[model samples]
Target: MEETNLYYKLGGQKAIRAVVEEFYRRMLEDELVNEAFRGIDMDRLRNHQTAFLSYALGGPVEYDGRTLREGHKGLNITSEQYERMIRIMNDTLRTFNVADEDRVKIEAFLRSVKPFVVGQ
Candidate 1:
């Protein structure tokens, strides 16, 4: 059997965009990660996040956004904040009815990249 890409498993561009929107909504409503989004351009953030997740999830789309390290530079993000965001993302995925196997893969991918996005 061949491995499947999450982007397609996630129902392509439409579903990915919905996931991004829901993820941001969850993040902003949750106190743990809400502060990180203050004064940020949410529309642009959603676009970049959609593209990045699409790319990370093995979609055909390419992310044109800044590297995670460059984007997170000077944020002084903490591991706790990062984990919190992951939790919110998982919740969003669950809400979208993503299968456990796929969600695990997505979470793993996000965690693998955490070092690049966290801390000074």
Candidate 2:
């Protein structure tokens, strides 16, 4: 049987890196979301995100980054901004041709973390 893990299905580290790169590109281009990333270390953030995504997708990697609330704390992210971020992520996944079922699962995972990420 084909591997059912989302990490494997999405082509592991390489594919997750590609998605994160594209996702950050879109986010940085977006006026609404770009401010949150201002002055942050892109390389470090990218690495953390890659690891985080891998773990989120059930990969072998463990995420050692800050907790969602702690990382986003003091950012004062608005609900609209949070929603926009989700849309961008959905768009990024679609651009990568992720299956609908997989996208749904991913979206659900993201949404499940909304409280921790939004009101930080």
lDDT of each: 0.88, 0.92
Per-residue alpha-carbon lDDT of model 1 for 1-120, expressed as tens digits?
114778888898899999999989888898877888889999999998888887887888867788899999988889999999888989999999999998898899889999999995
| Tens-digit lDDT track of model 2 for 1-120 | 236899999999999999999999999999999999989999999999999999889889877778999999999898899899989999999999999999889889988998998867
Error of 2 at 37 (Å): 0.7
Off by over 4 Å in 1: 1-3
Clashes of 2: 0
* Candidate 1 Cα lDDT to native: 0.88
Clashing pairs in 2: none
Q: What is candidate 1's TM-score against the reference?
A: 0.94
Give the winner by lDDT. Answer: 2
lDDT of 1 at 95: 97
lDDT of 2 at 20: 99
Worst 10 residues of 1 by lDDT: 1-10
Each candidate structure's TM-score, on Cα atoms with residue i matched to residue i, is 0.94, 0.95
